[model samples]
Target: MADQTPNSDAYRRGMVTRRSVLGDAHVDRAQANTTSFDAPFQKLITEGAWGTVWSGDQFTKRERSIVTIALLAALGQDEEVAMHVRATVNTGATREDIREALMHVAIYAGVPAANHAIKIAKGVYAEMDQQAAAKDR
Candidate 1:
C-alpha cells in the first residue's frame, strides 16, 4: 500500500542516519539486543522516523534535534532526552539551543517537565564536556 517499504531505500538510509546521530556504539548495542519480538518495531522506527523524516532535506539535523529534545522533555521521556541530548554533538545543537527548547517546553508542556529535563540536560552536558576534556588531555 505504501510507496516505499522498509526493505527499500528507506531502511538503509535509516540505518546510516541512526548510526550517525546516535553513534556506532549505541546503535550496535541496540542491534545486538534486537530479537524477533521487536525487530518489526525497530524496523518501523528505522524506516519511518530515521529514514523518511531524518534523511529528508526539509530541516537540518540540528533543527530536528532541537525539536526532538523539546518533545522528549515535554513527554517526560528522561532516558530518550538524555540520549538525544548526547546526539546533539553530532546534530550541532548547542547547550543554549537546548536551554531555549526547554524554555518552550516549560511554556507549552509544563514547568515540572521542563524542570526535570533541565536537570537531565545539565547532567548529560556535564558528562559530555568531561568526556571531551578527557580526549583533549
Candidate 2:
C-alpha cells in the first residue's frame, strides 16, 4: 500500500518551490486547467516531483534546471523545453547553462534534437529578455 502519511508540510513547501521556479501565472494556468481526468496526475506530480524530489536539498534549482533541460531535449519534448527555458531565469540558470546543456544534447540526443531545442530556447529567451528590458526602460 502506498504510504499516505499526510505530508502537508512537504506539499506546502513544494507549492512554494514550484511557484517560485515556474512563476505564479504558469502555475495558476496549470491549476485552472486541472480536470477530473488529469487532477490525479497533477496531484501526483505536485506531491512526487515537486514535494518529494524538488523539495530535497540534494540539488540547487540551477542544477535541476540543467538536468531538466537536457532530459527534455533528449526526449524531444520541445514544448516542455521551451517552458523550462523561460523558467531558467527564476532558477538562477543563465543562458550559458542552456547553451551548455544543448551542446551536450547535440552529442548525446543527436544534432537534430539539440538544434530544435536550441531554436526554441533562443526564442523564449529573447522574449523574456525583451520583457525585462522593457520593464527596465
Candidate 3:
C-alpha cells in the first residue's frame, strides 16, 4: 500500500466526495474564499461531514440528499438548502423528490420554512438548467 499520514485518507476521500457532490466549481470557489480564520472550520467539515457521513454506504447518496434537503429546509437554512438542491444532480434526487420532501418539511417543520426553501430550490433548479443548456450548445 502507498504510504499515508494520519487523517490523510479521510481528508482525501472527503475532498473527492465533496467535489463529486458539490461540483468542482462550487468547491473551488469555497476553497478560494476560505480565510485563515475559517480554515479550520472548512477542514472540519471536509473531513467530518463529507468524509465520514457522506462516504458511508448505509443510505444511497440519493436518499441522503433528500434527507439533507428536508433537514436544511426545516432548519430554515436557505443557502444550504439551495446548495443541497444543486447536489441532487449528482446524488440522483429529482426535482419532484425535492418537492415531496419540502411537503414533509411544511408539515413537520412549518409552512414558512418550506415556502422559503421552495423559492431557493426553484432558483437553484433554474440556474442548473441554464448551465445544462449552455453546455449542450
TM-scores, all candidates, are 0.93, 0.90, 0.89
lDDT of 3 at 20: 86
Task: Return the number of clashes found in candidate 1.
Answer: 0
Tens-digit lDDT track for model 3 on 32-122? Answer: 8877777778778888999888988899989989999999999988889988998998999999999999999999999999999999999
Reference-based lDDT, residue 137, model 3:
100
Candidate 1 residue runs with Cα over 4 Å from true position: 1-6
Per-residue lDDT, model 1, residue 52, is 94
- lDDT by residue (52-84, candidate 2, tens digit) is 787789999999999999999999998899888
Cα RMSD for predicted model 2? 4.3
Per-residue CA lDDT of model 1 for 1-137, tens digit only, reads 11223566899999899999999999888887877778788889999999999899999999999999999999999999999999998999999999999999999999999999999999999998899999999
Candidate 1: which pairs clash? none
Error of 1 at 66 (Å): 0.3
